[model samples]
Target: MGNNFKMIAKTLFGFEELLAKELRNLGAGNVKEGVRNVAFEGDLGFMYKANLCLRTAIKIIKPIQSFPVRNENDLYRKIYHMDWFEYLSVDTTFAIDATVKSDNFSHSLYVSQKTKDAIVDKFRDTDGKRPNVDVKHPDLRINVHIHKETCNVSLDSSGSSLHHRGYRISTNIAPINEVLAAGLLLLSGWDGQCDFLDPMCGSGTMLTEAAMIACNIPANINRKGFAFEKWTDFDEALYEKIIAASLKKTREFHHMIIGMDKAPSAIRKAQENIDNANLTDYITLKRANFFKTTKETEGPLHMVFNPPYGERLDRSDLDSDFDVEEFYANIGDTLKQEYPGTNAWFITSNLHALKFVGLRPSRKIKVFNSHLESRLVKYEMYEGSKKAKFQKS
Candidate 1:
């Protein structure tokens, strides 16, 4: 094994624990959780594996330098002193993404500019030529985060957000984010142990993520590339070995995975995405109203979906004649009456509409969908005459 180094895997809100657990399971050392991020120690190969397998991590960054800076000149001086040639070349293009949470530095753009100037000046002084900045498609992506006078500079290992799983070529209005979908699936404990269904599988993001989780497939197996591929120290043979090892660990999924949507267009788009993921054999797509369907399989069913919350007034997914309360009531009614011996989980940002679901949720987990605070609620429907478990007020 190569020398171990520290890396930070960034995640969304309410997903720190999940990312930490995932890191630990992947044999990461010195795993520690922070606000919306997890720190860990691993060799370069493990970094590749983390980007490929971790469902919740938005980006994995390798910190190159950290220092205290009270002013822009101090920041520039600290950055200029670093060995920029170790990471970037005169031919390489780069970009900076900065985040500031400090009273000392109020503008992130200025911080980014200062950092860029420092790096470029150092290169021009040493080699007489500096790498050009390409904000759109950078050969190397850098991250600068300042928190209360502390500045941390890191290299972004993932170029685009990890949510771009590459399989979702088609999408409907208000499609769920891929990371949120996978996290919700993991939270719901959908282990491919039983039959699975997504009632309102718009654009099939959730369904694709669920299928990958159930099959133990690498989340980014279909992704085009990572920023690490552009790194000077990247090892292609090592990454290939890691990919092969991960593929060897993929277990077989025996049960059926079903996705249903009322819109035929949604069904078509979902099918395209599923096919793009090459998961057609494992998932079945249907165009049917969720409220009109009943359980088709005999075994215990694991249902996870994202129903319309009437939160986005202009969303096309919302029927032209949508009724929020009545729709939620119908969802509650359908699950209670039709899906016996089942566990149904859904996320919604509409608190008012959620209240109209009639049955109290057994579990209401706090989560966020973009800027909207949301809840992932669970309802357990018992078989026969057993009472369904409901949450108490």
Candidate 2:
């Protein structure tokens, strides 16, 4: 407990609760939820474990300092007064990312510039030479977040986004982000209890994530590196122990995980990615038009996917009056006729097309795919002779 420190895990919108729950399950102390972020207490090893295991977190930040500032000069002075030597040396490379919501600070770039200047000047005064800024790849990445008049300075422990799980060497046109895919699968109540399917699987991201979750595999077990690996205090032995312990917890998954895509290229890419994740034994990828396919498994099925949104992709070949609406309607029809006793969920940016799905969504969650605002909607297909209730368009 003495080694415990506060850390914040940043996530996409509507995933705060999910992240908090994950932190709690991971044995974090004093877990709390915030807007698009979660706060928790853990030691340095736990930090490494969180980065390696968390499915939803985009990045993990360790707060170094917090203060009140009304202007840019104050911000610079407070930042300069901190002992930056603890994190960076004169030979180390660093970068600053700033986010401002204060009435006095309008530009985040300007704030970052001011903070950088303060750090460099402070280092130059003491050590003769100062650390240079390396935006693309830095030894130390500093985050300055200003909310109203309060400023929080933190070190970004995850250098690049956690979505780069290192296993996806291939991708389709609109490959789903791994973090978002994993979160969506969890949100849809995927527990490895039933057969899983991603009918329109683009690059097999959902299938790989589902298999990992089902088997209790560490989310980034295949990842080549993490930002913490570059830290001065990085303990390679401790990290190896954590990795071994996590792998020991892996359980057997009885249900099948399957993926289907009409595009040969998509099927190939999905297969390659699944193999890269070392989950080829647990997942099966097929090149079949979802509309023409029926339930291959005998028991209950769980389906999650992301189809074309008609924004960047061409939906013209879907049908004569092809729009997002018509495409979504086809999805609804295919699910109803072929996949009985299934829970189907998909995400789309085109809300107008959502009405065309015909089935009323049992749950709707707001999330963002990069810059596009999207929704993760769910449809329930009951078993037996009873027909599923759907809103007629």
Pick by lDDT: which candidate is best?
A: 1
**What is the C-alpha lDDT profile of model 1 across 1-393, one tens digit per residue?**
459999999999999999999999999999999999999999999999999999999999999889998999999999999988899999999999999999999999999999899999999999999999999889999999999989999999999999999999988878899999999999999888999999999899988998899999999999999999999999999999999999999989999999999889999999999999999989999999999999999979999999855464465646678788899989988988899989999999898888788887889999999988999999888887764454322
**TM-score of each model, in listed order:** 0.97, 0.95
By summed lDDT, which 10 consecutive residues of candidate 2 come out lowest? 308-317
Candidate 2: tens digits of C-alpha lDDT, residues 213-232: 99999999988787788778
Model 2 Cα displacement at 351 (Å)? 2.3
**lDDT value for model 1:** 0.92
Report lDDT (Cα) of residue 353, candidate 1.
Answer: 82
Worst 10 residues of 1 by lDDT: 384-393
Candidate lDDT (C-alpha), each: 0.92, 0.90
